[model samples]
Target: MKTGSLRFANIHLQEGPIGLLTSSLRKGRLSQTYIFAGARSVGKTRLAKTFAALLQCLEPVTGPDGSAEDAPSWRPRPTSDVVSVGSAEDAPSWRPRPTSDVVSVGSPDACGKCLSCRRVMAGSHPDVTFLRPQGAEIRVAQVRQMQELALLHPYLGKWRIFIIDPADRLNESSANSLLKILEEAPEKVVFILVAEQVERVLPTIRSRAETVLFQNPSHHAAREAIARVTGRPADEVARVYSLTEGAFGAALNLAAQDLPVTGLLPLREAQVRFLEDLERFSGQVQERVNEAPSLEAALAVVEDPDLLLFPPLLASRKSLVRGLLLAESLPAAFPVLFSRVFLDVLDKARKGLDKVLETVIARQKSAYAAEILKEMDRQFGMAVQNLFQAQVVGLLECLRHWNEDLFHFSHTADETWLLNLDRKDDIMALSLVRGLGFAESGIQLLSRSLELLSRNVQPVLLLEHVLSSIGGRTP
Candidate 1:
């Protein structure tokens, strides 16, 4: 087996930033440590692995060599192309490059026949390291072990590569451990750190590495990848790709499950209806401060990341708020004006700002646009923090309520909610509430509360804040 390499693979290569980065690396000018910053499912991990493979490929490739020994290592076999005219015609499958190429990924591009490549593809490669958070965070101990491993020579390949996924998950200690490695990395020891937010990592780490940004792929590219990988039709692939918001992993995951296009109907309808609801609701509240509590509840549900409908709603809310402020209409929308305290949060709902920015760019002043962007970012950050806190709150509330419900009825001092928590859904629900121990009861209560609150009735939403008096518990 040869070392794994993704160089010149038959995969449908998406053009743009990722393509540019890959092209540069193929020319053998890779950075010591690379920060691949992008949204989830933007192929950050995939690209990093591919680059690592290329760097580790033992049979180093050069441009179309004239010598016989330098001949192409692999060639595409015979295949028929779809006819240009009339009915869709069948195409023959290309041979030589087996489907295993997609499955077995490693450095120096895993040649199918090499023992090293085969072992790596089989997940037994001693030289290749893929490090991810074992739990909520990547601990310093885990990172230290990785560093120790990095200090040793590669058991097989010339280069030793370490890929840290979601590198932002590293706690301060873990990150600091990695910083030491960066300071004294041995020659040919490479680090590829993939993160959803590059800024979250230590600035020193960012300064030591080149930042390679990965932009979202177009619907066309996502569709092609889904089709090629899943053998699905173009229309079906397009549907799933669109529904996933062009997240390749989400789309491909759906394809693997063989879910039908109709499966996305509710998700799509919810997105549209939720946006309209927020626009109409925000307009109504724009003149009423007394309505702040109710509006907040509604916004919470709309912005629920699980629903994926909040971005548009929040974006609409931002625009409506700005309009009211500009027109000196704060008195009319007292509740909304009060909520404006959190307006800095509009940033996390990226989908909305992406849309709003496009609309405002044509008419809004550059200075005003800059201000709005800044506020949006603040709001976005706040929204994320609030969401996390809310989840934690939800769990505590569920636990308190579960015990209250149990003790209130049982009238026994020796009882425990853990013993009587029923139903898998209840447990699943509590897990969603976040920060609560993943006990069955906690999960169930969270699930029930979320379901009840989403209906927009505040009275039925009492459970949402039941834990306000509960002891503050850290996640």
Candidate 2:
């Protein structure tokens, strides 16, 4: 309909899947549904979005069938034929001869800058949408919405494209909901579900879509490519590679986190306060509960995060752990360590129990208090599930960087690229108090903690030991 101004960028390290899909498009053999499964950070989502852009590009490189490559005219409605890129031919190139030029995309290419491509890349294309699990699972409500929208005609492009990332997150009900959509989607619509593991996805959904596989590129090549993007020296790249264990996403994040080391001072302060308050107030809360004759008489001192920004609430240890895996993550995670989990419900239960001041009333407080604690325990259990926690290695890496920067700044006091710029004075003060020696010892302690953690040592004991050892020595 319109001329494509977009060009495909050779950004992925793994080009096999790209070439496969592009060649399929040229041959007019695209499928109605595709399962682009791969390891995390191998570019499945990136490729999926790029493909959607190509489909919506104003100037599409016409396929062997009858679509126009450079046609200057317009076709508001797609010919009820093409999917994102199917394998079987829809028709021979025998439609009305186009007045404009037609060039086949032998290699993967798109006029990425065109109006259509731009909208698609920006994720604003009327015909394209993305879906991912909001929390632990993709609910049936989400799939139902997708199904309803899939039946509609394209608002701009000839077809509608739905990209579902980490599709395995669909629980049983949601997966069933998705399966129905896949089984009955229209010819002009396309579904691309990207997943890291196929077994987690329902087999019926898998059966309906063509499974496309992607693998990690060699670490040497991945590092070089990452270095190009980061503009870091070879040695630094090597360090990142080693830290990330060849994961490009992790490596990129580490390289980009070159901020002032003092930015974590507030978060560090919050963490200490939270831990101290948690330990300090629990006994008082129990005492108040025991003394109270009725629920109306209970009160207690506790932690809250009203002063912090909290959306998608930092109420779970998994979320807290994830948020703290980077220096950038500390503020979010640190507040959560003090913030109430499931605050709305927890508050309702607490108020229902006639308690205020965030008291952890003892089970002996009466039936109401026991019920409140029971609910708290249930919610807390859910939050502490292993599935939600951030990787230990990630947390360690972030801590390692924090202490490393403090050590470097203590002597050099350089701010070329501080990770915690906001806490410059605090960092300087800490450096003054502990000096370089204290920092080096803190780093060693953290390293030992990581080593013990990796070896499956008791997490609570190891953490307590590390905290105790570093307690007075740190700022």
Candidate 1 C-alpha error for residue 19, in Å: 4.9
Tens digit of per-residue lDDT, candidate 2, span 327-397? 23232232333333323233343343333323434444455656666644443333222211222344444
Off by over 4 Å in 2: 1-7, 60-105, 229-231, 242-245, 250-388, 391-393, 396-475
RMSD of each: 23.4, 14.0
Q: Candidate 1's error at 297, in angstroms? A: 41
Q: Pick the candidate with the highest TM-score.
A: 2
- Give the alpha-carbon lDDT of every model: 0.48, 0.55
lDDT of 1 at 173: 92
